[model samples]
Target: MKDSQPELLHLDSDEMTGYPNSPLPVLIYRQVLDTSNAEERADSFEAMFKRHGWPPAWRYHLYDFDHFHSTAHEALGIFRGQARARLGGPHGQETVLKAGDVLVLPAGVGHASVEADDDFCMVGAYPPGQEPEIERGDPAQLAAAQSRVATVALPENAPVGGPLAALWE
Candidate 1:
């Protein structure tokens, strides 16, 4: 194991590559999926994954009244708020994240915050690896736009096999 990485990584992913860029790719927005009337929308995230039969990965949602953002390799920001998105950038674009707002973020999208109320929170998931954030394209007006970045974790209970298992074999 490399001395730079967390020890748990050895037990988790097959290969943990080091990131080589700065100002990582991240996605920022307001809340989109909630439980009030957006229950189905939230469920669709899982359904979409299940229908595709993709491997499980990092998925989490916080009910913080403060702020947060998506850190997946590729994240989607949906609008759950009543208003529309204000901040506009090439990368961390803001939108009135609603219940069903489908955000199609490719790997390396960067953002800073995705705010929702304590009532319902924004949920996000991603496979292993780092999702880099793109700085807000504008520097004059929206300097307050924070850089959005989050590192995705390994899938839950991924069995040891292949290259990861071969290390021992």
Candidate 2:
């Protein structure tokens, strides 16, 4: 595992859209895990997230269509392959994610996979007691989604641990 600090990136919301992206920035932690062995890489992420209070919930690829979650924050650990994903909305920022990377997304932030390799895989998790509900970018649902997102509680621990947790505060 890498001990260096992670590179942080934030994607602010475009108010015109229904996606109520949070004030918290979209976190990107690069090479935080060892990806040489597939099974071990996955285990490390599960262990880290669970150890820090965000229990590992699923393993899969990101959705291809634009969507967001107003119910809880999400932590995704890329365990295999790589992909290009968009954030905020359809026209939002595009980024590449590879193995050993972790993405911490605040509630209501939009995300969609533009393209990914055949082997691409990720482990997703959320804060203890928090569950995710999918919300497509629909203007009609904006008000309700915003209301829910506003009331959603923050996680007590960062998924990756260390100083990176301070970004949420």
Candidate 3:
């Protein structure tokens, strides 16, 4: 597979809610897949993640509230329809994503689905051996979640492209 330059956006911790967002920037790869077939697109995305050592990709719709993964970084490849999402945290930025759009989210980065079409679907993957633990914005779990975020290691490579040295290194 060929490499593509993706747009990068960095988000900081949400001071008001005390949500520890990721230190690593979020990557947005647009038009990664040219085909319109949702199944073909999903297959290609899964294959790409496996090649990058981030396997066990799953298919589902994103949750509708602000949440983060404490233990694993994640990648979302949109295969069907379009949706608006809030990233970083409740106070984070909002962006629209469509079919063929890919998002690479570092562990602890908050994301939620703001709105979506009926056919909206996504393929999500995590780094090998890492299972994502869902953490909603709760003050009680703030300390533990922040600690986990701080210790989560960066993935060896980017989800779609081969390596992330240029952006992640």
Model 3 TM-score? 0.93
Tens-digit lDDT track of model 2 for 1-169: 5854556656666556777787778888888897699778999999999998899999999999989999999999999999999989876889999999999998999999999999899999998777899888777778888888888788766788854447865
lDDT values for all models? 0.32, 0.85, 0.85
Least well predicted 10-residue stretch by lDDT in candidate 1: 6-15
For 7-42, candidate 1 gives per-residue lDDT tens digits of 111111011121211232222322323445555554
Query: By descending lDDT, how would the candidates be arranged?
Result: 2, 3, 1
The parts of candidate 1 lying over 4 Å away from their true place are: 1-36, 53-72, 77-92, 127-169
**Model 2 score (lDDT):** 0.85
Mind giving the per-residue lDDT tens digits that candidate 3 earns over 72-164? Answer: 889998999999999988998999999898999888889999999988999999987788988877766777888998887777688886677
Q: Model 2 RMSD to the real structure?
A: 1.6
- Give the Å shift of residue 140 in candidate 2: 2.2
Candidate 3 wrong stretches, greater than 4 Å: 1-3
* TM-score, cand. 2 vs. native: 0.92
- TM-scores for all predictions: 0.37, 0.92, 0.93
